[model samples]
Target: MNLTERLAAQPMSNPRADRVKDVAGLAGRSARSKRGLFLAEGPQNAREALARHLESPCVDAVYVTEDALGRHPDIAALLERVAGDRSVFVRLVTREVLAAMSDAVTPQGVVVVCPSLDVAAEEVLAAGPRLVAVLARVQDPGNAGTVLRAADAAGADAVVLTAGSVDVYNPKTVRSTAGSLFHLPVVVGADLPELLRAAREAGCGVLAADGHGDVDLDRLQDASAARAAGAEGVDAVYDLARPTVWLFGNEAQGLSAQEKALADHRVAVPVHGRAESLNVGTAATVCLYASARAQRRGADRP
Candidate 1:
């Protein structure tokens, strides 16, 4: 019940102990992909997970070292409150072992293992007239996380990543989110066509970003009919509050011709500076925020 008892009670070993040989081993898609689980490392993410546990209990385990205990005594109180919950597991490790299991130069002395959500197309579709980001094979971990974080900050309902997008649960991605991951629903391993179909069915418009698109993002903001919705039957209105998926493609190739064809509108972010183009993540942020602002404007309209 007390802080001292809680700290002393953290399990040091289990009846059936499983030793993780290397932190890098858990980085692969196969292990994480198969288990539908991922690791969140560092003080920030671990602390965020603890905060979530305090709020509604979203994580499975809190693994830490003595150094972490020394630094963050508050976590002991958090662990004590929810430790009896079936999903909550707490463990303490040696500093050397913690260092081996950490990816950072300076390990924050704590990490969390949590369930990776297998978001359904139906759920995404059900969020009608919602703002969503569809990441198509975004490779960079930081970029992918930034996009998700931005989407959440902009009030996008959810983010659906195509089959090839970077792992949303990567340590760097989790860190970059800065706890926005907890604030939004992120669907990974979604099929592009199925997602597109859901968007259409839900009366959501798909806006694919392309450097060559005839329509500019500003036009969409103004609610102007610069580009007509395609024959796919998606909504012509680029209403962010309505179901909308802002499609962002790979960093190197951009959106494929077929992918662009599926979009109800293809809009480009106008750039005046010498930069060739915006990064996929940056471009996504600009587009998502614009939709968020426009959606707010629409809400305020009448």
Candidate 2:
């Protein structure tokens, strides 16, 4: 007699259910922004979100077809309860229409509209000793998404994209996050100087990556080692677990001289390959993982 039982027992007729086919045609970011809503698609992620947050009634609207109901039995009940409201609809979309509506190439035949979490920079930093990846002017959506995934995997406190970075909500970028977008705090429209000042005030050290730097990032094992080196103007060098910010710059030009000057220290990943430099995203993942390694070492030390 529940929603899933109802879905399983009921008869189906409507092929093109009452749902928005072209989500892009529905509204702009301002509308989604003002209403605190964003699109969620695919069966696996949809079911996960429903299982985790929908039971609390946080889910606003859900669009599912009869086929999706049969395929995703786990979420059928949850979807039915949420979809009962007029605001929610179980729409039947043609595979072609769903494909167009979906950001992913292979439409999962299910999608939902839900609330977005507004994550603040200070709140994220306050969570603990921060590991923040500050991405400056990174235009490539894939690169941006890869950096976000890396930040999530590296257990970063937050990821901040300064002005000029690709849109975080762009379907391509969002699709590339692979569900990490939901797990971490992402702050866009960052003010570099303000962030730097705040990190410094919070006792966090800032390290800017440059192909040309005073020291290789692989060298600094811990805060004590960095401090002992006593490199002039290098501040406390870098302790990745000590509320640190890692600055990655544009893909083509790398870090600008002005941006480079803002860091307390410049560090570079040592290269042994034939290539002169790592791709922006590859370099970022390596840098973030290095921080993770250093932090693990710090934690293990008695």
> Candidate 2's residue-wise lDDT over 206-273, tens digit each?
88888778867766654544443443354444566456789999999998998988998888888987
Per-residue C-alpha lDDT of model 1 across residues 1-302, encoded as one tens digit per residue: 44344457754443223444433455666877777677778776776777776786688766787778778867666766776675666677666666666666677888777777546878767757468888998888988888988998888889888887888887778778877787777788888998898788888888898888888777566552222221233343455444568899999999999889989888899887989999987899899888777666656553
Most accurate candidate by TM-score:
1
| TM-score of candidate 2 to 2 decimals | 0.78
Backbone clash tally for model 1? 5
Residue pairs with backbone atoms closer than 3 Å in model 1 (clashes):
129-241, 129-242, 129-243, 130-242, 130-243
At residue 302, what lDDT does model 1 achieve? Answer: 38
Question: Predicted candidate 1: what Cα RMSD to the true structure?
Answer: 5.1
TM-score of each model, in listed order: 0.85, 0.78
Q: Where is model 2 poorest over a 10-residue stretch in terms of lDDT?
A: 10-19
